[model samples]
Target chain A: MVDIAAELKRPKIDAHCHVRAGREEELSSQRLVEAGEMLGITEYWCSRPITARYGSLEEIRAGNDAVLAAMRRYPQRIRGLCFVVPGYYREACAEIERCLDAGMIGVKLYHQYKINDPAVWPVIELCTQRRVPILVHAGYVTDPRTKAEQPRLSHGADFAEVSQRFPETMFIMAHIGGGGDWEWTLRALRDSSPNVYVDVSGSNLDDGQVEFAVAELGAQRVLFGTDGTMAGCVGKVIGASLTEEQRHLIFWGNAERLLAAQGKQPLAKIESGQEGVAG
Target chain B: MIFDINAWVGSWPFRSLRDSTPQQLTERLRKAGVAGAAVSQIEAILHRNAQPANERLAESVEPYRDVFVPMATINPTYARWEDDLRICHEELGMKGVRLFPEYHGYEIDGPLAKRVVAACRERGLPVQIPHRIEDMRQRHHLDPARGVPLAAIAGLVAAYPDTPIIVTNARGIAQSPLWRRTELRDAAWYADTSLAEVYFQGLDKDLALIVEESGGRHLLFGTHAPFSYPEAALVKRATLPADADTLEEISYRGAMRLGLTPESWAVKAGSA
Candidate 1:
């Protein structure tokens, strides 16, 4: 019998997540970690919450600083993703170096510029040299409301283009469900190079989405994420028709590979005897 | 045992759904720990006349009658829908009705909708209105149905205070102005937890907050299955910060009070 309850309690990594520092917001950082922990999410690969402004260096630094603080507050539960805007190529590259030096495992890019834009190439190249994955803000916003709000949002086509240009760099397309038009996004991702992976996260709990992503992108290219909605995030994967191996890959195995490739380690081992690292 | 108040059968044109047949739906529900579900037909939303869809739903679920409670959909805008409602209630033995105001192109507070609600009230059957079938942002471009706002549902509730209204696939109820109103609180209405969430995009909103806002009385356990994963609601229910009584109420009691009885025979030997 498939012990689904035990599977739900397995130590999983949420690849795309956000937390707020207690500075401007309340102790939402603590709440995000607690909520994920309650659902057996052992680690959060998180960045500061996305904002409307991605053009300012000060804002970029502020976001990364918040993530650093969250990492310090929950050293065992949180792993930092350095947030940066690639429009400032030189400064963006420098920030990547600073964050990686400070122990962040990956880079998070938002919608100031498309991932394929020439402005972002240097940042991609920097991450490639540093052996860290770039978690790019991706969505195919077809609806008027999201379109108007995220006119510059990156889509699967952008990832396809960027991934091909920099074949050596690994790219994670953020939030297949969070992005508008998931079906369209999945179709677009079919042409993306193998380096482009998609995270199954967001509040839209539509059935068959996780299975569809695994089918379209292949199981190895899919990662589990909450994007803030923890239960829905975990549930969509559990609800989908997947084998134990596919579930493990999406839940933690693929994340383990990514973390290992980046030469990072979880601050604490999983107490459930489900070691996050495959040693 | 969890009783899912919202579920569907039939093919959705935009996307292919898994486990949508009556037999398939039961297995899906069982895997998610749901003992029974009140199911509606998806084709009714798109069909100009819903009687055929209702007939299909009744026939499809005939084999698995104990595990599935057939809920008919009647587009009041269609001609002679009262007769269809009568056939569904009297002949088909459907427990209740589900309406699609946005897809059927009728206002929630319009005369046609009122007739449906009034008739259901007279029959002592609850009316379930799905706030949306598909998420608006990701819906097929050709499909232009918008979500029925909470205010419109609230308007219907105010007009027919005695009618039992169950709103499924609803979002942002806790944040809406109608939340916690005396009429909503006191009425025999409920909102299912299929689409409810604890947090989204860094906001402290969704299910847990909704339960806190409503004091857990107005919530029901729902999966929106086949269209949505049953595990979504199941996980949300598992994480609710409620005591045993409140959890029981949300899980099955609220559904029971709505006149939905989980067939005792459907429970496995050791479950009860």
Candidate 2:
């Protein structure tokens, strides 16, 4: 019998979490990290949250700065993902170099430009050469209202197209359950690109989502993420009808392998009973 | 023991569900450490008349009475609903009734809704209102289902302050304007911690934040399972930064307060 409560206590990695640096974002960041800790998350891949559809160059830099700040504060618990807007090619490339030099593990992209957009190509190539993953914010929105609203939001097909082009670059699709039709998103992701992996994040928590994603995309291409809903994400993984090996892969094995290949190690010294020790 | 206040055992027409049958639901719930669940039928939401669905629910759950607390589904808009409600309570031995105002095509705070609540109240039965059966964003293009708003629930609770109200599969109840109203807040009302779970926003918006905000008194454990995975809700409850008392309140004590004690119900039925 599966002891789910005990299973939840197993150490894992949260592949997608937003940890910001602004006055208010700091509190949100702290809560997210604390929640992850309570849920036995060992490493949090932190990114700067972008509220606007399109952010200024300064905003993008500032977002990456916040992630860097979080990494400095919780060196073991937090792993920074450099956020950039591919539309700002030169600046975005420069920010990626700066963040990567400062120990950031990968890149985080939003819908400012679709993954397949020409402007994003160089960014993908840069990450591919650097041997880092590009985590793209994607939504397969079937809802006409949201679809019209976020016309530029990248989808599974966009990732499929872009990923096929840069077969060497590892691509992490943001959230299958965040919004839009996850079923449609999973269906689109099926047998598309081996380079394209998806994070089981977001608040949807639909039954059979994790199982379906595993079956559709294969376990190696599925990652664990909360996108802020920490417990729900953990629950989706533990609750699914997966082999222990599959659960391990989703929880931290895939991430551990992927980051290790990029010469990145998130947890240097896993601390216990460390709370409210902000730098 | 964990008593899940929100769960369903029947096929969802829009999407294929795993472990949607009573036996499968029982096995899944047990694996997740849930001792019992208040289960309804998924077909009841879309079926023209909910009587047949309720009958099916009774038969399906009969074999798993130890794990299932059957809740009848009533479409007040359908004719002879009163008779169906009576049969569900008396003959079918249902513990409660769940209403789908949005799916049933009627105003939640309208006279017909009030009549159902009043009738259930007289029978000392709780009324469960699921905010949405499926993720509103992921519904089939042809399926036009909408979620039950917090405002409509406020209206229902304000009108019937003494009625035991269970609002399941809802999000943002604690942060809603209606939740701040004394009339709705003080009533014998409960919301499940299924859909309104942890999110990236500030602690005040999701279920984790509300455990402190509402003292866990107004919250109950729910999976909205088969439609949603039960593990998500179970893990969410385990991660709540709450004291033992608060956790117990949300897990099963609150449900017990709502008269979900099958032991007492059986004794009462036998005596009657």
Interface RMSD for every prediction, one decimal? Answer: 2.4, 2.0
lDDT of model 2, residue A59: 80
Write the residue-wise lDDT of candidate 2 on B1-272 in tens digits: 68899989998888888989988888888888887899999989988889999998999888887778899999999999999999999999998999998888998889999999999999999999998877666667866658888888888899898898888887777666457776566787888878777554324456655676677867889999878878888877876768998998888778877867556544544576
TM-score for each prediction? 0.93, 0.93
lDDT tens readout by residue for model 2, A1-279:
456556666778888888756775567667666765667787889888565666887888888888887787777778889988888888889999999999998999888788889999889889998999988888887667767777888888787777777888899998888887877777877546787899999888888888888988889889999887777788888888888778877977789878987876648323343211211
**At residue A117, what lDDT does model 2 achieve?**
94
- Give RMSD (Å) of candidate 1 vs. truth: 2.8
Candidate 2's C-alpha runs over 4 A off are: A268-279, B198-202, B264-272
Model 1 bad stretches (over 4 Å): A1-4, A21-26, A271-279, B180-183, B199-205, B213-216, B262-272
Per-residue lDDT tens digits for candidate 1, residues A1-279, read: 233465567778889988775474336677766676667787888887455865567777878888888788887878889988788889989988998898889999888788888998889889998889999888887678877777789888888877888887889999888847787778887777887899998878889889889889889999999887788788898778898789888987788888888777655455444543221
DockQ per candidate: 0.57, 0.60
